[model samples]
Target chain A: MAKNLVIPIGPQHPSLKEPACFTITLEGEKVVNAVVGTGYNHRGLEKACEARTFIQDLYIIERVCGICSHIHSTTFCQAVEELAGVEITRRAAYIRTIMAELERLHSHLLWLGIAGHEVGFDTLLMYSWRDRELVLDVLAALGGNRVNYGINTIGGVRRDVTPELIEQIRKVADIVEERNKYYIQLALSETTLAARLGGIGKLSHDDAIKFGAVGPVSRAAEVPDDIRVTDPYAAYDEVPVTAITDNHADVFGRTVVRVLEIMESVKMIRFCLDNLPEGDIVTKVPRKIPEGEVLIRTEAPRGEDAHYVRSNGTDKPDRVRVRAASEANWHGMKHMLEGDYLADVPIIIAAIDPCYSCTDRAIILDNHDTGEQSVTDWRSLREYSINWYKVRGIDTSKIKIAYSPLIF
Target chain B: MSELIAEKQALATILEKFPFLEGKLEIQRRQRIISSALERPLFEEVFGFVTTDGGFDNFHLVIGVDDGDNLGFIYVLSNDDKVMLSLKQSAPKSNPAIKSVCSVFPNALWHERELVDLFGAIVEELPEGPTYPLPDGWPAGNYPLRKEWKVEYFDKVNMTYNPPVTAGKEEE
Candidate 1:
């Protein structure tokens, strides 16, 4: 019998872009046990949301995930709107749907690139990211920012989908659709992709449900629990959207699902643009929502984005709970990581598209790790980084920086 | 069938399957969201029934709320392509305990770990995990989400080490 080796893979590592630590216990090359640790980026966004007014929280909530900003704000606004008993016009719904799908397009493309990078397929990474810019350009044209597009408001959208914007989105959608078709063909036909990813990170259909996996991770396991189709919001009920599923139950399954879904998003964008409705974009909803609780579930590109808003008939909410798609997927991560080679860990984590900043909503600063000098100010952190990098033969001491107070 | 009838049928179907849920559940039309209130003791039983016999297997999320005297919890569960149900329960603020359904719904453990941190929720058999979403070595006895809790509670940590003369207070 051999003793298991414990290996830690980061709160900060080369493989993971975000901050999360996965402690993997391995027997030679095979992972015998895996424990996923996250908490390095906790920002207490929910607590912040509670203290601010609905209007103020809109900006905070939208900034939850830089990738799927609109979906988070949409869920928050829909919950508030439901509590306020306000009905948005069809034009508003359609525009919101367009934004949501456009977001999904960009998000899935981003994931595709990340997944490719994880698997050492640099060409695919280059291709997907290059095409992703087109989607980002359309989003920027509509909302004035490439990311964190604040197009959503309480009762309706802040900006209307103009004729020029519609034409621009349509052109972008066509290009993305054509490119994703090639990716879809590559995902299905590429023997090397199948061989490398086919049996890797295999999560069975039953285990996917048992572990409460969401998004393409669950969809890859052949579970069609898509919030977009199951509980439609915005213009999803009107737009022709179908849940994409694959039976591979591995990283390849996730890749296939995301590529196919990009095509579906393109189809949705074209449909919404062709039948663009005309009317008022914003509605007159109250500043103070009534005393009630409403739960909103919307499909983010990753998976189900659920928001729970409880109002006390006041301008600010009583409680705002956000269950990002990645949180649910994290529950099933241990199941995915174990029994695979340690080398396959990064892609498995990437397959779920873990967003640490969104999930870490409790709190950050360790107020009680006493007696040990931790990062107190920008200058100390800079000094520590320079020393640490100098030890690794990288001289960062040449870069001069200014001292600043802790922006707590 | 009309949306109202479909919603009614959905509610009736659940009520018929679990007699304990009959008086506690109501559906909101157009939204197709059903909210059910259950006592804390029955929380575990309801979780079992729904996942096994009651046909609601997909557990989405568990939200813990602090309501002054009592802490409220809402469990979001659904069937595949079916109606969404928010099952609610509350415990007194003094205890704020919840039965861990991780044995049935493996995902509840993560949400429960979060409840332990932000709301000071005590879950029986929570199966040891990290103090999620909260940095390691976070001060105990401070639950930030409760109405009574303020950032001032951590003033001891915040007050340490004065900043440089050039800081946020400094005029550019």
Candidate 2:
């Protein structure tokens, strides 16, 4: 007899941090089907961006993602700048480029650390996180904040970089660069890691393209789909970018691509600092942007971060849509999650380095309807889950979740 | 830039095939982006051509817009050289429907699902599944992304006005 056990992995699962629920059907320990649901933390940012003034929307847009804050804002600013016909100074372009690379460095380091933690390599987590602060320090000095660096403005960047600042950034980048090389060797060669992650979350090159996966995920699958390399934004054209790709096409490949890409970020930062152009950081532009629509993309550390701005010749935009890199990557997740062992679920989900949006949850029925086709809030879902376990003779009633203190 | 993707050729082929889109097509060379506004009926044909023969098959994303009288969708696709083409199509606000390109671009699944939830843009052939970017059992007719759907309107509906979901169901 083939026993099929339907398992809901999130919405409030302790192991998963993101507010996404994956309903996985397992036969013994093997996953047969997976349906990915996200959107528990929906902030209605796109709609909100439309109602507010362009200046006000910049703040809202930056909040779209915690890790890739600058990338979001920079892409938004670039679209607005393009629409306003404001050609930013060479120095501003280089500074934005430098900041972008610095962001990539910190973000990749954060992912490496998280991957380490997920895989039980806590030493890598501690070391990588400690080194991450070095990149954040450069960001703090430049943008005056570690997260949501409000460095980008409509016409150009708000901050100006001095030659001295460039040298300091170069020093930090080089140090981080050396550390990443070591990580690259470790992630690629570590035997235990290879055995654990090599074939767990396999997404082939054909599937990667068919599903339109991006950033390191696609690169790991050998798709070589990177916005930074394909279309030069910021200082990418001035400073060369090598889109690091791997053929592993699994969690291991993603790991290698990300670590090697961090090295690429270091090289980009060095080039920008050494060839630091001199000029005013910003250009004056009109407040009322002429009616036009523009779509702009930046290679966010996670994937292709795209922003579309449609103006109606007004102080406020007619529409502003932010397709965060994570949104694009989510489409491929079900494909990855299916056919993997139940034990490998956590590392597999973390392998994407997901920075999830709080939007909503869903229940997908594929032919075999379980009469659970209903939109559920956290409270009911939690109750149902607890009751579900209790019915099955496993009491999780004593599990005290600190975040949801009201779950009595 | 290759022979198939050289700026003029990529933009012109669509216009040549669909002559009605002659004035609607544009190519911004510096940014390496192009735009062509096609009718609702012509979306599948043009998109199928672009993805297959046109060599710009990378399905990036779809942006759903709420125009005053019509609903707009911009299907963004790119090629290896990084040339992006925005295939713009719109359906009348009263009808408010568009075709799904999922058969061509499998990744259009979620993006199309999002359009269905937020804008209430009826995506024909959008696989019957759970509502996306929106929770289940959300009021069927209320499309939150439309311009007429104001922030204040949220207060009247349980979608916004209801007490936080994190609170235990026992309280209610």
Candidate 3:
């Protein structure tokens, strides 16, 4: 019988954007079980919302995620708008959709590059990242910043998408479409990726549903759980989503689902641009929101991100609890990682496009136990792994290190 | 029937089957939001019926609110486009414990843990583990999400601070 060995990866691992420790118990190289420990990056955003007024929270929530900032702000605005009984203009709705889809495009591309780099394919990483800058440029052009655009307001969008901006978006979309097609082909046919990812992190169809996985991760398992289609919000009602799904139920399935969704996002952006309505973008809302509670769900690139807000007839919210898609999706990683080899950990984790920073935004707090906390940065983690092999009487000098940029 | 009427009918079916849920379940006439605040003991039975007989499969979220005297929990469940249900329940602050709903919805385990670590709400039958979403060895009894908890910055280093007036309550 193989002896049980425990490996603790991260509160600061390279693949993880925020601090989360996963204790993987292994029987030889196969993972027998795994446990997740988080809260290193919880910044108390939800509690902070209680101290800030409705308007100021738009900025605070936007900072919850650099990648999906707009969705967080939009979801907050949606819930508050519902509470205040303020109806935003039709033009504003379409503009919100455009910004959201554009954000989705950039995030998926970002994930693709990160996933590529995780599996020792730096070429795909480089290509995807360079192409991703185009989407970022479009976002910068529209919202006046590359990330955390701060474009969403209490009732509607803060900025308007001009005709010239639409033209620029279309041009960028055309280029992105071409690049995405190549990525789709490469992701499907790439020999190294196929060997590393195909049937690597399998989660059955029932497990996806049973675990209540959302967004592309669930969709890849043929669950068809896209919030944009199921519960249409913003201009999704006007443009709509086809909800791409795959039966593969593995790392490859997640890759295909996200890649196809990128194309879908591009199409949706173009459609929103073409069919955008004419009206004032912003609706005037009162400083104080009425007493009420509301739930708002937005289809973020990673999955279904939701915010539940309660107001006490005051300027500030009584409570704001956020449920990021990653939180819901985090549970399923254990199921997928079980029985998988130790080497596949990074790619398998990247397959979920896990955004620990976004998931742990509201949870980050002070670490008072400085005496006991042994901070293991990425470089040290690599060193420790290599040394662990050496200590086990295995020579590690022959292993060649591949150069991949630390994008996170 | 129109979409609006069909949605109403689907929600009506849930209320109709569970006759005991009459006064507790109220529909938001404007948005067709089916929501109710029930006693703590009633959550499992009500939620069970909502999933089994109510045709609701989508577990939207579980929100734990620190409502001063009591810790309020809102279990948001939905059935596609039919109805968005928020099952509200609360346990007294003196004894902040509620039954675990992981058996009803597996994803509730995450929310249950969040409630335990953040709001200090004791979820009965919750599996013992590390302080989730919170670091291990985090100062005991410091529930950051509680109402009175505040972050005080001294010398640009933030620390969890609660006013002396609200300190020393055993959340367990």
- For all predicted structures, in order, the TM-scores are 0.86, 0.86, 0.87
lDDT (C-alpha, whole model) for all candidates:
0.82, 0.82, 0.81
Better of 1 and 3 by TM-score: 3
**Model 3: which residue pairs collide?**
A39-B133, A41-A364, A42-A363, A42-A364, A43-A364
Model 3, range A16-123, lDDT digits (tens) per residue? 666778899998899889987766778778888889998998899988887888999889999999999998999999999999999999899999998989888888
Model 3, span B1-172: residue lDDT tens: 2346646666678778767777766666433464566776577677777788777776767898888888888887777563667778878877888888787677778788888888888889887777666656566667778775665521123434444443535322
Error of 1 at A281 (Å): 0.5
Clash count of each predicted structure: 0, 9, 5
> Going through the candidates in order, what fraction of the true interface contacts does each contain?
0.92, 0.84, 0.68
lDDT of 2 by residue, B112-142 (tens): 9989888888888888767788776676666
- Please give, for residues A1-408, the per-residue lDDT of candidate 2 as tens digits: 978999998899977877888999999999899988888877788888888999899999988988888899989988998899888888899999989989899999998988888888899997898688777767878897777889999888998987667767877887787778789889878899788888989899999888888889999988876778777788777788888999989999999999888888888888888788888998998889999889898899999989989999999999998888788887888899889999999999998889943222334444456555545554465578789999999887676522222111
Least accurate 10 contiguous residues by lDDT in model 1 chain A: A399-408
